[model samples]
Target: MSGDNPVDRPNGDDDNERPEQSKGGDENNPFAAMFGGASTEQFAQMLQGFAQAMSSPSSGPVNWDLAKQTARQTVSAAGDSSVLDRDKRELADAIRLADHWLDDVSSLPAGCSKVEAWSKAEWVEATLPTWSRLCDPVVARMAEGMAAAIPEEMRQSAGPLLGMVRQMGGVMFGSQVGQAVGGLAGEVLGASDIGLPLASPGTAALLPANVRAFGGGLGLSEDDVRLYLALREAAHQRLFVHAPWLPARLLGAVEEYAKGIDVDTSRLESLVGQLDLTNPEALQNALSEGLFDGDEIANTPAQQAALRRLETLLALVEGWVDTVVTAATDGRMPSALSLAEAVRRRRATGGPAERTLATLVGLELRPRRMREAADLWKRLTDARGVEGRDALWAHPDLLPDADDLENPEPFITGASELAEFSDLSQLGWDTSDPPVEGTPDDNAPEANGPDSPGNDDAGPADGESPDGPDGPDGGEPGTDRP
Candidate 1:
């Protein structure tokens, strides 16, 4: 006992004993230099620290608390101003009005149940849950892959500490997510700006400060910008609300991609070899440097297919939102065209935060063929009218594919399967029934303004919004959101 503790060394090996390194050399044993040549003392100290960290392992795959905290801090540093009551009222009014106008151009009815103006920090909070859902699969897989990549000899050498590496992975992934989300908070105007439902199914939220920032260089009035963005938000909500299959389909694609993530054993080995675990911040920094960055991840065919599905879905969403918003705002808002062009440019170029998010997810959400998708939607609208175009969203199968984005005439005309349907009801779309209350009805007298009854003036009916506390799309018509 006074000499050296046998318990500290693996299998009570002598002090001079060394683990056999892989034939490829020390590079293969990433933890060799990482742990000072894998010394017993270093292992003991790291284990002590990991034990302390493990005491509170409630954070599942990602340390969501750290993510939220870091995101709030980043937004605060970037000057996140709390949204005022007036800001909320203005946005609520804009959303109501935008929804009213959308009725004429789109088949989906009023989708937003809860409308609020969010600060950048608030946006981060509201959207983090969805981000968690989207990121957890990939993050968990990455952790598993990395842990499995540990050399067999190193595994026996590191003992239980190797299993705890996943905890470190969580922290690192959380850090990256926090930074990426915080960045996106500054860039996104609403939960749906990136063409995915980042908030609750029926929740319509917008960052007013970001909206103003977006419209700044465009020389458009702040009100006009807000209304235009509001139209986009409402348009997105319509689909999110009416098309129950959408969120799952869109999110499922990401999960599918995650399932196909081909973790490079060599890369993980190299990464382990190079990581400076002495500094926790170094681990976080390394994640930002692209743990899954280009060429590092070899995309499998399944992954490519998932990406294509995701891309097509995203493009369809963006294109539909653009078409609906343009139709709703044109002639009504003098700056509609200008605003549309600005949005197109913003999406095409992307922002710093968008790029950061892309890096974190290993996927760029640029709807690469958004314009083409929009044209296809417009073509469908021309061929079958708004109801027909919207009907396609009733089922994922009905939506155009990547090929259709190129030459949509066949799909628009009678070449596709949709032509077989005499009416949308055959495809599950019920056109005969009148739209439910809160939904826009063409035959009904139009509300004079946003303040009119049944619009923003009335509060949630019976203490619940259409898609409120009961459930998403609870009171709405169509298949309930799953």
Candidate 2:
């Protein structure tokens, strides 16, 4: 049997449910007079107030039924949401190999994440909690904006419906998100390709068929593709599991930016009024098309810094994964180069899951900072060695910011001991000439002091620099990291 509380409309749902669908003088329909009479903004205002009231210590977002219904529909549309038993065993085997291979190259702990091969639908089910947490803050702010505009009269008469709409909106968006993500289930190579640990930390999961399908576009064989993807996935899991604060930091930055989003009610009113109940995609198109438009929602002063931090962090993750995976498969995989290129292109263009996330919450997960971050990590590893580079993850303060990603040399070299190695050749990476011995390393080239949270600390610390892991002598708040 179908879920009892299914959403009344799966498409864009803005229609009122009354027998007389005419745009006449029907007192029952608040929207009936919307054609030429009084403004419907008043009704919008009431709904907004209702949303706020319900949200005050609010327990839930949307009605759960809408989410489930939409998810089921999306799964049905994909026609391959179920994970095959054989694929799961294959994924586990691949991840096991990945774990062993990674142990030989990096100082990261062994076997932190459990490996699971998930069906597309299963992936959708498992990842929703994280998605909700990431997106709720922005949705709350939007709801707040809507609530603040409600009229006193509307609150006294039909305020209940206001709350209903907010709930409806939540489910509507969730359904849209589920459908979008479902479309992507057959596309993603692994859980972390989107840059965040979209899977449970210490657990490696892949969709075998999906992985094969992704490889189909390129001319690469399935075995080589799976091995390459497994390396990346395992590398990602290593970082997230070992770095305790990263997941929270990444999620927090997103929420902070979302909180500052300023929505224009006039536009929302027009959007809500014209919303078609049977066309969810059309509603999405309207928002992106500037129908229910507001001013641009980019970084604020606070947002600018936060966004930069997030971008840098995200970039570092990709960089680290890229370096580690490339090294792990060195001479081992024939299609490594081709696979790397394909992954980069995939990220740049973005998959359906990422696009769906953008629509659900205003955040885009394509990793615009990836190249810079990768360069920064490669530079640091070259200066300090892998252990030294990985040590930065022990504490947030030690991590590099966008600026540090720009210079890289100073941050990594500041704590690196050249005397410890046989020279630059032992470091193994070849980016540029080594910095002058005894020369001061400056991450912020022209600046005299460190940046915020010492976020730009990417240059490997010269063995002599005081910036190395502070042994109880550090001045920074998060300096005790590692």
Candidate 3:
């Protein structure tokens, strides 16, 4: 027998036997040349590696660790510079003083228990958990749509392969989230730059590097820019802390919107079938262009309402912060007005990262009526003091509705009147009752006619003295009345 024969080979070596040599035309076979004529063992190893990757524990809708790692890598690759110690100290001092200044302007007390300066990477790490909360609902919906895209019969036949598909979906969603967050990290100036409480409670963080970049071309002092940004951040922290229900309310709107997400199964199925797993860039492009494109999904009426609510709430928060920060920095920073206008313009015209986030979540963070909302807040402050203005946050019902933004006069007037009424009630006044009809009006002519009680001069005209002893000084008699 030949040495290569199965009879002479080892027990396990039989499965590894090579095919008979091909003719000269084999050299011209492109497929063989491309893979270097991969042997059966090599292909098996590749499949094994894939299987191992697929078998990773399916956490939730996203592989969070992978997402974090990818975000850090992305930030690193984007050249996120470290914050110098001096800059860090300056940031801390600025934030602290900003909080102090805010205390004078806003009723909400200082909320930041700790302040720190961060690099872009640190920002990603600190804010990732909040992003997860914000993103989970949408990502879960996408994962469900992906799984449901397959027919029941096909899914049953897929067996273990179905798990692999789910794992792949997690990876894909995680990658997209990482990309969005990394892009945002490079642009955000602080934890609350996006008008959401992205950082942990009692902690205020600033990105010195990003702050420096933002102030570079404005011809403004770096200190003024940092201080202005710090005031905004500090104001956000105060509002979020004082209004305990706000965070949940904002997040609930996002989730409510997410609940209405319905993916087009046909398009998703087609995309999945055509996805090129070997090329990550191709997969990302396909996802963005095909699966997540406008044509692939549509929001329901409820989702639209939820989005409106979210937008209004965001606008209110940002507007209040803007008003409060402006007040706090009014005289202290000479460049405050210019900085405020710059910030407004920046927010009104969002950057690429914000747009990308909107595309991904189907919810725009940019408050369309931010200016109007800010005006409303300022009107409220002018009509009602800071206490009355901040009291609106005491209850959701007290906050201004979308209609209130169109003409804030009614809302401001009503709020001020209500506050005044509340004060009267607290002082034991019966505001419900009508005023005494004959009560002397302070601005009316003096009551000098005969009908008045003080018309004693006419009544006693015939008397020797108009003022009798008892009438003038309440003496018992005219004798010794002094």
Best by TM-score: 1
> Which residue segments of model 1 deviate by more than 4 Å?
1-55, 274-276, 279-290, 296-298, 352-357, 365-368, 415-426, 429-482
Tens-digit lDDT string for candidate 2 (279-383): 645544444433213235553454444454555567677888898887788877878999988877665554443343343333444333466667776777677
RMSD each, Å: 16.0, 15.2, 27.5
List the candidates ranked by TM-score, beginning with the highest: 1, 3, 2
* lDDT (Cα) of model 3: 0.62
lDDT values for all models: 0.64, 0.55, 0.62
Instruction: Give, for candidate 1, the lowest lDDT window spanning 10 residues.
Output: 1-10
Regions of candidate 3 where Cα sits further than 4 Å from its true position: 1-56, 273-289, 292-298, 365-368, 415-482
Residue-wise lDDT of candidate 3 within 1-482, one digit each (tens)? 01111111133322223222221113222112111232344233333334444455446776666567667866897898888899878988998899889979976667666687999999988887777766777778877877877778878888988777678666555554665577678788888887666766556788998888888988999999999998888888776665655765566566666777877678778877766767655554455434343532434555555666666677788889888988887878889988987776665455432343354344444434676788998988888888778777754556786677766786777624345534433432222311133443221112211112322233432222454212432221111211
What are the per-model numbers of colliding residue pairs? Answer: 1, 39, 0
TM-scores for every predicted model: 0.75, 0.70, 0.73
Model 2 TM-score, 2 decimals: 0.70
Ranking by lDDT: 1, 3, 2
Indicate which candidate wins on lDDT: 1
